[model samples]
Structures are given as C-alpha cells and as structure tokens.
Target: MRIAVTSASGKLGASIIKHLIKKIGNQNIVGIARTPEKANHLGVEIRQGDYNNRHDFDKALQGIDAVLLVSGMDDPQKRIQQHRNVIAAAEQNGVKKIVYTSIVGNDSETAFSPVVKSNRQTEKDVQEYGMQWVIGRNGIYIEPDLEYIENYVKEGGIRNCAGDGKCAYTSREELGYAYAQMLLDEGNNGQIYNLVGEAISQAELAALINQVYHTNLTYEAVSVEVYEKERKEALGDFLGTIIAGIYEGINIGANDVHSDFAKAAGRAHKTPLEMVQEIKAQE
Candidate 1:
C-alpha cells in the first residue's frame, strides 16, 4: 500500500516516515509537506500538502492508498477547517484509509481545550468519512522537559502548577512506531487508542532526571496564577498561557489516563528511565 504522511517536514511526521520506511521501504512512502523542499532529505517522493489548500492535497493525495493526518498547529478554530480540507481532498482522491494523530486533554477546562476540541471535531469528521479510519490520542510529550534540562539546571529545580497529579508522557519515537502500525494494519481500523506511557508525578520526573543527569534538581509546585504569570513573562502571552493551561490540566489529573500503547503498537511503551538512558547514550 502507498502511504502518505502530511506535515512531513515536522519532527513527529519525520519520525513516523522513518519508521514507515523501515517497514514498507521508501518507494512505498510519500512525504507531504507545505514546503516540499524541506522534506527532500527524507528520500521519498515529496508532495506539496498545505492543509489550507485543497488543490494542493488534490494532487498530493492522488494515487495514495492511505494517509496519516498530523494535527495542525494553527489557531484551534482555523485548524478545524484546515483539517477538513485534507479529509475532503483525501476522499476526492479516492484514498481508502486515514489515520489521525489527536491528543489527550481536558475538553472542558484549561487553555488547551480549544485545541483538543478542534482535534475532536476532526476525529468526528474522519470517522464519518467514507473510508477506513483510526485515531490515536497522544499523551504529553516528555522531550520538552529533557530538552529544557539546561534551563532547569540553571534554575536549580523544576517549578510548575502540576501539584501531585501524574502525567502520562510519551515520546515522538514511540508515537511514530504506533502510527506506522496503525497505518499498515487493518486490525486498528475504527479504533481510537490512547497512546501513552507510564504516568508519573512531577516529583517523580525530577527524581528520574536526577538519577539520569546526576543533578540535584527539585520540583516545586506553585499556584496556577503565579505559574501562568511567570510563563507569560518568559514565553510571551499566547504560548505562555497555553503551556500554563497544559500544566493546569495536569494539576486536575486530566493527563493521567489509561494507556493503550501495547495494543496500538503491538509492544510495550518504553519506560521513562529507558528514554532518559537512550538520550544519555546519544550524548
């Protein structure tokens, strides 16, 4: 089957394409990106696939048997229609199967709700489409924390509004493997899987970081308002509020959900310790 992955220039999209190449070979994979040149290094047939442009997808998805729709990063309201453009184009092009990468979040509370709601709408659209479909609600990615280790070290600890709530974190690599399986395996059709790893509290994450990086960093829980203010000061108004909202959801236990990683990927999700160890090995 010929599989097309949208947003192929992105990290998550690229990771999924990498795994797909291993499973099906580059000849059978298509990389769809808004800037096709940016994805040339992926060594697949690159097509221009701007989510806002139905004409682009009309040509891009032509002759493709299946598609992987990576959720868009535009404003939540705008992205709903953008996603539809791709879905409609896929149908027009006679694509047979579609897989969407959704997210796990509190739909009622938090600044992140709009994004979640948008994805939910797209999920509904894909399910109602005249084709086979599978959806995966991804957990919070742990890479940001690992990437921010330098800043955390300088700050002497990690400070957030998560309190004692646990977060089910997964990595792009893990999500990539699962998405590849979802695209190729018909058994996952019509299934919505919560792709998450082991849940752990902020304090536990700090301890793991300490063990892996050999640092004496601590986790301090702060008030939501205070954390929001600090994040705003550091990251500006828009992104800061969104980041704060994610932590607020965590504080409310929205991120601690049952994981279907094993069912989705046909294997167990990697442990947090193993993830950190892999990073250390890479360093």
Candidate 2:
C-alpha cells in the first residue's frame, strides 16, 4: 500500500516518514508538505501542496492508498478548514484509509484547548466522508520539557499550576512508531486511540529532574499568571504565553490524566523516569 504522510517537515511527521520507509520501502512512500524543499532528505516522492489547495491534494493522492494527516500547526481556526479540504480531497481521490493525529478529549469544552475543539470538528468531517479512518488522540509530548529541564535543575525547583494533577506525556518517537504500526496493520479503522505514557505529577517530575542532575529538586504550585510572568522572562513574550496557556489548560484538567495509550499500541508506553534517565545520560 502506498502511504503518504502530511506535515513531513515536523519532528513527528518526519519520524513517521522514516518509519514508513523502513516498513514499506522508500519507493512506495510519499511525503506531502507545503514546502517540499524542507522534506528533500525524506528520500520519498515529495508532493508540494498547501492544506488549503484541493487541486494539489488531488494530484498528491493519485496512487496513495492511505494518508497520515498530521494536523497543521497554524491557528486552530485555519487548521479546521484545512482539515476539511483534505477530507474532501481524499474522498474525491479515493484514498482507502486515513489516520489523523488528533488530541485527547477533544470533544469536551476544556480550558484554552482550541486544538481539542478543532480536532473534534475535523473528526466529524472525516466520518461524514464515509472514509475508513483511525484517530490517534495523542497527548502532550514530553520532549517540550527539554527546554525547561536545565533551568529546573539549576533553580533546584520548577513551578506550575497543575498542583497534584497527574499527566501522561508520550514521547514523540513512541507516538510515531505507534502511528506507523497502525498504518501497516488494519482492524483499527474508526477507532479512536488516546495515546498516553507514564503518569507523572509536577512534583514527581521535579524529583526525577533532581535525580538526573544529582541536585535538590522541588515543585512550586503557582497561579497561571505568576508562572506566565516567569516563563515570559525566560522564553520571551510570544512563546512564553503559548506555554503558559497550555499549562493553564493542564491545571484545570484539560490535560490532567489519561491511560488509553497502552490500549492503542497494545503494549505499555514509556515512563517519565525512563525519559529523565535518558536525558541525563546524554551530554
């Protein structure tokens, strides 16, 4: 089966492309993105197309049997429309199956979770198209912590508003592997998989970071506003604001906890402790 992965420039998308190349051979794979130049190293047939362009998608899906639609990173509003275009094009082109990388608990109205709502709308569109699809409801990735881990170690503490709420953050690589497996193996069509990993609280994460650096570690539960201030000082206004928004959503249970990931992959996922150890061992 010919497989095409959208958003080939992204970390997770690139990983999935690589995995597909190994599973089905490079020649049978296709990579689609707005900027095909960025994905030149993918070693697959690159199709240049924007999510908004239905014409481009028609050409891209010519011989593709399945598509892994990596949700766009643009504004949530635009992403919803773009997803609709892809769904329409896929139906017109007769793509057999589709796998969407969506977010967990997207059907509910949670705190500041625009992606959740947007994904829900897109999922509905896919279902309406009468296509065989699998939704991988991936949780927050643990790799984002790499930016703050050193600072947390240096300050000997980390502050967040999640309090004692637990979160099951998945590794991007693991998620990519799971998506590859899903594409290769059938029987999961129409199933929604909530991908989660080891559960870890902010305090537990602090302890793990401390152990990694052999330093004293602590977690300070603070309000969203206060954390925003600190994050802005460290990460600048724009990015800091975005991170603060995500964490604020976490505090209110938008991303608090879940365990359905193991069910999707049919096995246990990675844990925070293991991730911390790996990070420490790296230079």
Candidate 3:
C-alpha cells in the first residue's frame, strides 16, 4: 500500500512523514513537496507536488493508494481552488483514500469565517469526488504559543481580546502521528474527526506558563483595539491582525469543540500543561 503526503517539507508534513516511515517503512511512502529536493532528506520517494497545478499532483500522486492533503496557505478563494485542483488530480490518478488537514470551524459565519467557509467547500468537494476520505478538522496548534514566550516574559503577561474564552489547543507533532495512524488503519472512510485537546482558557494558560518559567506573568483581557494596536506596533499590521484574529476566534469558541484527537491516537491526548512542558523541554 503506497501512500503520499503533500507539503511534505513543512513542519507538520515532515513530522507526519517521519512517523509514517517508522510504521510503514520509507520505501512505501512518498513525500510530495513544491520542491522535491527540499524533501529528499526525509528518505522517502520525493515528488514535486503543487496544489495549484493539477498536472503536478497527478504526476506526483501516481501509484499512490492513499494521500494526506494539507490545506494550502492562501486566502480562502484561492486555497479552495487549489484544493479543488488537488482533489481532481487525486481522483483522476485513481487514489483511493484521502485525509485532509482542516481547521476547526464548520460554520461559515464564525469570527474566523473565511477559513471555515473554504474548509467547508473543500470538504464538499472531497465528498463529491466519491472517494474514501477522512476530514480531520485540526485544533488550533498550541506550539505557536512558544513563539510568544519571550514576549510574554517581557510584557509580564499575555494580552489578548479573548475574554474568558477557552481553546482546545493541540500539538502539531502528535497530531501528525495520529494522521499516520489513521492513514494506515482501514475502514475510516467518510469520517470527520475533530482533532483537539481539552478546552483551556487564557488565564489558565498564563498561570501554567508562570508556574513553569518561574515568572509572574498574568493574562490580560484587552479590547480588540488595544490588542490590535500592541500587535501592530510589535509585528506590523498584517501579522498583527492575523495574531489578534486567533484570539478573537478563540473568544468566539472557534476551537472549543469536542474532538477525536485522543481517540484517533488510541491514547490520552496531551493536555495544555503537558504541551507547554514539552515545549519548554525542547527549548
């Protein structure tokens, strides 16, 4: 049974590929990346793949029995189109199973509405293709918070507009392992798994970080305007808006769904506390 992973050079993709290699051997897996050369180190067959190019994916997915299609990093309309191209190519190439890494939002009118709409459309397209499929709506990754550790330390707290809202933050690395398991397992066709951890609030997160780092950091609930201002001043408007939107999305319960992250892995999923500890250990 041959399998392929798109965007195999990315952090999550590479982690998935590694876990797959351990389970299925490198020879049975194909790592598809925009530049195949960048994925050569993965020790699997490297193929040039692009979500925007049907021909590229058609050629890359050749002889593959199953595939993991990581959603493209683009605006909603463009991303959905790219996903369509990939689905078309996958179907055209006769691939049997597909696992998509989607975000956690089924409603189109949510705070992070655009991505939800695109993912919903993509899910519709995948289902319309009449192939065995699994749509894994992944939770907001907790790993990204590590990037703000220094800032939190400097500011003596975490600032966001997410007032009392909780999020089910997940670890990207473990999520990849679960993906590999799902790909290897049989009879999960047409299932939609909400991959998430326990719902945790920002105040709890701040307290945990303080406990771990031995600092007196607090969680401050600011207005959207103030949060946006601080982020824009620190990281420019584009990234600032994106970052603040994550908190805004959380406030609206975008990532608060009950999920299959633990069931998919057939084990207890890591908690936010464990995830933070793991991050600290790595650092």
Candidate 4:
C-alpha cells in the first residue's frame, strides 16, 4: 500500500518514515514536507506539503493510499484549521486511511491545554472524515531531557513542578515503530492508542540517566509559578510557558495514564533505562 508521511523533515516524521520503509519498502512511501528538498535525503518521493496550504496538500497526497498527519506546530488556534486543510485534501484525493500523531494531556489545566484541545479537535475531525483512521496519543518525549544532559549537570540536578508524579515517556524511535504498525495494520483502524512507555517519576528518570551517563543528578520539585518563571526566563515567554505547563500537568498526574503501546506496535514499550542506553550507544 502507498503511504505518505507529512512534515517529513521533522525528527518525528523522519523517524516514522524510517520504520515505514523497513515495513513497506521505500518505493511505496512518500515524504511530504513544506520544503521537499530538505527531506530528499530520505530516499523517497518528496512532495511539497504545507499544513496551511490545501492546494499543495491536494497534490502531495495524490495516489497515496494512506497518510500520517504530523501535528502542526503553529499557534493552537491556527493549528485546528491547518490540520483541517490536510484532512480535507486527503479526503479529496480519495486516501483510504489517515493517522494522526496526537498527545495526551489535560484539556484545561495548563498553558499547554490549548494545544491539547486543538489536537482533540483534529482527532474528532479524523474520526468523522468518513475514512478509516487511527490516532496515537503520544506521551511526552524523553529526548529533550537527554539532549539537555549538559544543562542538567550544570544545574546539578533536574528541577520541575512534577514533584512525585510519574510521566509516561516515549522516544521518537519507539513512536516511529508504533506508527508504522498503526498505518499498516487494519486492526488498528478506529482506535485511539496511548503510545507510552513505562511511567516513571523525575527521580526515576534522573537515576536512569545516571546509570547511562554516570552523573549524580537529583530531582528537585518546585512550585508551578516558580518553575514557570524560571523556564520563561530561560526559554522566553512562549516556549518556556509551554514547557512549564507540561511539567505542571505532570505535577497534577495528567501524564500518568494507561499505555497501549504494546497493542499498537505488537510489542512492549521499551523501558526508560533501555531508551537511555540506546541513545547513549548511538552517541
């Protein structure tokens, strides 16, 4: 079956394409990107697709049997319509199935709520589009913490509003594996899977990082206001607030949800320790 992955230049999209290639062969996969040239190295047909442009997606999705819609990174309000553009185009082109990469979070508790609400709207849209659909509510990605290892070391530990709450984290590679199955397996149609790994607290995550990197990092809990202020100072208003809001959600146990990764991928999700080890080996 021919499958298309949107936002192909992105890390998540690229990873999904990698797994899809192994399952369906590169000849049957298409990478759609806002800048097709950036994704040419993926070694598949690259088509121009911008979430904001329905005309471009109309052409990008042509002759495709299914498509993966990577959530857009625009203003939450704008993302709704942007995602609609792709869905509308997909339907117009007679795509048989569509999958979406969504996230799991409370819909009204944090600055990140708007983003979650927007994803929900798209989820509803995909379900009602009269085509087969699968939605994966992705857990918080663990790569950022690994990428910021140096900063954590400099700060002497991990500090956030998560307190003792556990977060279900998943890696891009794992998500890619699950998404490939979701796109290819008919059993996954009409399902909304929570693609998450084992849930762990910040302390547990820090310990896992220590095991991999041999650091003496500790987890420190702070108030939501304090953490939000700090993140805002470090990352500027928009991003910092969102990051802080995510932690705040964690603080309230919004991220500690049931996982359906095994059902989605046909295998258990990798442990946090395993993920850390894999990334370390790559480094």
Question: How would you encode candidate 3's per-residue C-alpha lDDT over 1-283 as one tens digit per residue?
Answer: 9999999999889989999989989989999999888888998899998787888987987898999999888777799889988888889989999989888863653335776788888988888998898888888888766777887888778889988989988887778888998798775667888888899999988887887777788888988778888888989876777677777878877778897876576667787888889888988
Clashes (candidate 2): 0
lDDT of 1 by residue, 1-283 (tens): 8999999999999999999999999999999999999999999999998998999999999999999999999999999999999999999999999999999998889987888899999999999988999999999998899999999999989999999999999999899999999999999999999999999999999999999999899999999999999999999998999999999999999999999999999999999899777767777
* Model 2 lowest lDDT segment of ten: 104-113
Considering only N, C-alpha and C atoms within 3 Å, which residue pairs clash in candidate 1?
Answer: none
Superposed model 3: Cα runs more than 4 Å off: 109-111, 232-238
Tell me which of candidates 2 and 3 scores higher on lDDT.
Answer: 3
TM-score of 3: 0.94
Tens-digit lDDT string for candidate 4 (1-283): 8999999999999999999999979999999999989999999999999898999999999999999999999999999999999999999999999999999999998988989999999999999989999999999999999999999999999999999999999999999999999999999999999999999999999999998999999999999999999999999999999999899898888899999999999999999999999988998
Candidate 4: pairs in clash: none
Per-candidate Cα lDDT values, in order, are 0.95, 0.79, 0.84, 0.95
Off by over 4 Å in 2: 105-111, 154-156, 213-215, 229-241, 278-283
Error of 4 at 99 (Å): 0.4
Best by lDDT: 4
If scored against the real structure, what TM-score would every candidate get? 0.99, 0.89, 0.94, 0.99
Q: Write the number of the candidate with greater lDDT, choosing between 2 and 4.
A: 4
User: For model 1, what is the error of residue 117's alpha carbon versus the real structure, in angstroms, after optimal superposition?
Assistant: 0.9
> How does candidate 1 fare on TM-score?
0.99
User: What ordering of candidates by TM-score runs from best to worst?
Assistant: 4, 1, 3, 2
Ordering by lDDT: 4, 1, 3, 2
Which stretches of candidate 4 lie above 4 Å from their native place? none
